[model samples]
Target: MNVSRCDLLRWQFDFTWSLFDYHLERLQPADFLWEPAALCWTVRPDATGTWVPDWAETELDPVPVPTIGWLSWHIGW
Candidate 1:
């Protein structure tokens, strides 16, 4: 059986999306903003009421862990 390159790529994408969906389905609304550590990155509503993720112009020595909301925003961004 021969699989085209497109077919392989499609399968991989589907598999990855399924894995993401599996975990996403289990997440509660609160989980998106839950901070697992004291020094963590998350999204905050700005003065304009738009949600913004924590960011830095330069990398920090200790990387801040991202909240699920931040990660999701990053993935989509």
Candidate 2:
């Protein structure tokens, strides 16, 4: 009963996506930009009106909590 590497990878991918889909389906529009804390990182529109994620050249002492939108953009980035 040996599973091929490809099969194992596919299974892993499917499982991961299922978990993501579960949360994704439950997300509300407001959840995307909801700041859970006073100090948090999120996406904001630039002067040109293009949305961008808050980022730092170097990691800060306290990593900022990311909003759902930031997390999503991060995953895609």
Question: Model 2 — which ten-residue stretch has the worst lDDT?
Answer: 13-22
Query: How does candidate 2 fare on TM-score?
Result: 0.71
Q: What is the lDDT of candidate 1?
A: 0.89
Off-target runs (Cα >4 Å) in candidate 2 are: 1-18
Candidate 1 lDDT over 15-70, as tens digits, reads 87777778888999899999999889999999999999999999976999999999
lDDT of each: 0.89, 0.89
Give the distance in Å from residue 54's predicted Cα in candidate 2 to where it truly belongs.
0.2
* Clash count per candidate: 0, 0
